[model samples]
Target chain A: MESIGIVNYWIVIALMMIALYIVISANNLIKKIIGLNIFQSSVFILYISIGKVGGGTAPILLKEPAVYSNPLPHVLILTAIVVGVATTALGLALIVRIRSAFGTIDDQDVQQDIERN
Target chain B: MIAIELVVNFTLLGFLLVTALYISQTNRLFRAVMLFGIYSLLTASLFVALDAVDVAFTEAAVGTCIATILMLSALSLTGSRKEVRFRRKNATFAVCVSIALGVALAIGIMDMPQFADPNAPANLHVAPYYLQDSYSEIGIPNVVTSVLASYRGYDTLGEVVVIFTAGIGVIALLTARTSKPKED
Candidate 1:
């Protein structure tokens, strides 16, 4: 049981690592953005997982009924998801502007242009 | 319970470590920025597992999301990371110091109350009251909203101020006349 739990933990962590690696190692701008999205989703999963209590039901309060998972985390994650989408929009907007300005999105190419100037 | 928690925590931590390595070794600037965002997000997950909802939310929103976008914008202007050329320089020293500090913190955390132990200080403190009475106290179903809007109202207001200030700064930066040579 203990090992199973540990494996689950590692699996989440491993996904995070894979996403991070893609973000860092990829030369493509789009790939980097994808990695960012993956990373954020991982955190979202973490928040939702922590809030779950064993044998707990959904967090809605019901009269004469019992057992509810904590609603707080769900609420928090909802807000966070909204924020994430907004940020992604802004980020893409910036990327568009960047492409227009530099004519190339690759980091090295832009830097070379700067150096030449 | 402890075993499960430990596995979860370790998994999250392990992912973070690998991501850090990925960032350090990557040769693309845009990719590095994205990785930094990913790193922030993974850390946020760890916070959630620790039952720190507020922290996890902030990390997910500001750190992973907004921060990543800003970084990408900066990357567009700056270009990719320089190709790895020579031997390691100062990296070993930096890594050793950081690792030492991290280990120290982990040791301290080991002494902390077990995750969700009913008798733990955090579980028994004002947190439970907030969890139990948030609905009645504020007439809100979402306990986090009640806590943020009411219990920790002052802090939330401060955050709003910070955001307001940031907006003002952006406006000024964008609207300034005779913007000389700041590339893009």
Candidate 2:
């Protein structure tokens, strides 16, 4: 309804699109993992931006100013980041196994090999 | 002062975009990994600007350190060079889908509250309660930690299990079937 004053969300959205495009378009599996990381990171940025208060400092309680950013999103994202790393590690391990088994890492070649087998 | 914040915000975002573009387009897998590391670092700074110090710390730790090292190890197993190019059809389809999704999300964002509005729905519901009562309830100064480990204990427990399962999965995938090993 009103003109947007904040541009952080839009920037995050753009990053999301870029990450998705990379995931869909990249041929290398490693590149795809990197894209997925970017996608997840953008989502974290979006959440953190939402939690921000106009004049808030970090959520650690101090005597100075009372304003503090939302702690919920930060906590949620902490779990998400740890899970993301675990997932990434698992994905890379799978990739290594694939390369060892097929003797090729290219998606097209791997597919062809599977079909032929 | 506000102008400086705005400038820093945009500049970090600009760097993010540039790094993403390079990562997507780079043919060298090693170079892309390096760029992705930089992207994570930039996002960490952005988190700090948003007063999400805890998120920034985790981002720096997990995104920069763990992800990059895992990727490089994977790269060492696979070849460093990407395939010649993506198929034209796949590239076109990816672009179309990304554009469509981006447009839909941008439109949805139009109704959302402006950045850092204290009265926004997210800030109003649940968050204020956490902030107000966290110290008394949990006897902890760090609201994030109190809420994460105390109020939301189940969620954190689930996360730990998920991480454990992932480690097991990696071990299963990488280990060999045969138990015998040659003497060194």
Candidate 3:
């Protein structure tokens, strides 16, 4: 039961490792971006998971008394999600430019092309 | 009830792990993007399970919808399918680094508070104050909205500026090629 209680954190860590693996192993620039997205999203989960209280409800007030989960993490993650969107958009835009410039999105090909140039 | 919760949590984690593995293994860019969208959707559901409705909403919107659309558009321009490479050394290095890092992280997590411990440091901090006073101070039902729009207004404004800057950067990058032809 103790392990079960902290299972959330363990899973979050596993997801992070998978994301890192994808980022490091994949050659496609877009795949790297996807891996990065996975990494960021998993971090988001980790933060939100830590903020949970055993019996907390969502952080919305009502007439009846209720336990609420931490609002701070939710607020922070909202800002992060927005920034993530912008960053991803910009990244994809840059990838488009890279494709146009090098004719391939593979890291090795692009590296060799740069060396030849 | 605890049993049910544990079951659901583990199931979601299992699905997330599988989806992530699929996304990494699929060399077809379009399939990978679709799987990433699925991953985001599952993550959003997990956020809901963790009682993060606002974060879940944002994840569904930005993580799944907007990010997927952006990646697909980029794929249209860049083309699908990854270039297969037989870089054994790089693969081995990446595997080693990822395993080392994963093990270190797992070991570190052993000291962390349980998933939903009410007495955890994170729950004992300013969060208690926010939960107690947000309604009276801001008169908003959603504590997250109040904090984001009022207490952290300046930060939100900065984020807006960031989005604006990114939009401008994307526009500039996309349009630069048109200007090159004219210059020639």
Candidate 4:
């Protein structure tokens, strides 16, 4: 039961590590960006999980008394999600520029090109 | 009810783990991108289950809709359908480092508050105040909206600036000339 309670965190940690491995090991720039998005989403999940309270509903008010989950983390993650998409857009744009400038998106290929030049 | 919730949580998390694993292994960039959309959808559903309706909605919209579109557009622009397959000399090293860090973090998690403990410090600090007073002070039924738009207006402003900067940066990077002028 105790393990079940924190299973989400464990799974999130695994996801994070997988993403980290992808980002570090993958030579493709675009794959690295995908890895980065996964990493960011995992962090978002962690924050939302932290804010969850057992038996609590969404943080909306009602005339009747009700328990609401913590709203602060939700608010923080809302901004973060938007910022995350913005970052993705920026990253993809940079990739497009790199593809055009270097004629290849593979990290090693670009490195070889530089070395040859 | 608790048992049902536990089952659902476990199933969703299991699916998430599988998707992450597939995304890490696939070399086809297009397939990877599509799978990432599925991954984001699953995450949004998990957010809904976690009582984060607003965050869930945003994740569905931005993560699934906007981010996917942006990635697809970038893919078409780059014109690369497959990742270049090469012998990864450092793959073993990276796996070891990730496993080591993950173990360290998991050990750290044992000291943290138990999940869903209402008395957890995160729940105690400023959250209760926002949850209780947002309605009375801001006249909004949604505590998250009131807190985001009213109480933490400055933070929202900063977010807007960050987004604006990102937009400008994307435009600048995408529109810049990549080739030098040819001499006649």
Clashes of each: 7, 0, 0, 0
lDDT of 3 at A39: 94
The fnat score for candidate 2 comes to 0.78
Q: Every model's DockQ, to 2 decimals?
A: 0.11, 0.61, 0.64, 0.66
Candidate 3, residues B41-114: lDDT per residue as tens digits?
Answer: 99899888878998999899989999999999998887765544545677678788889988999888888988
- Which residue pairs collide, candidate 3? none
Best by DockQ: 4
Better of 1 and 2 by DockQ: 2
lDDT by residue for model 3 (A1-117), tens: 355667788888888988998899888889899999999998998899888877678989878999888889899999999999899999988888877777778888789888886
- Candidate 2 chain B lDDT trough over 10 residues, lowest sum: B175-184
Q: Is the docking of candidate 2 incorrect, acceptable, medium or high quality?
A: medium
In candidate 4, what are the lDDT values of residues A1-117, reduced to their tens digit?
344567788888999999998888788888889999999999999999899888788999989999989999999999999999999999999888888878888888878877877
CA lDDT for candidate 4: 0.88
What's the CA RMSD for each of the models? Answer: 7.7, 3.6, 2.7, 2.3
True contacts kept of 1: 0.02
DockQ of 2: 0.61
Q: Best to worst by lDDT, what's the order?
A: 4, 2, 3, 1
Error of 3 at B118 (Å): 0.6
Residues A1-117 of candidate 2: C-alpha lDDT, one tens digit per residue: 123355888988999999999999887788889999999999998999889887688899886659988898999999999999999999998888887777766788789877886
The TM-score measured for candidate 4 stands at 0.95
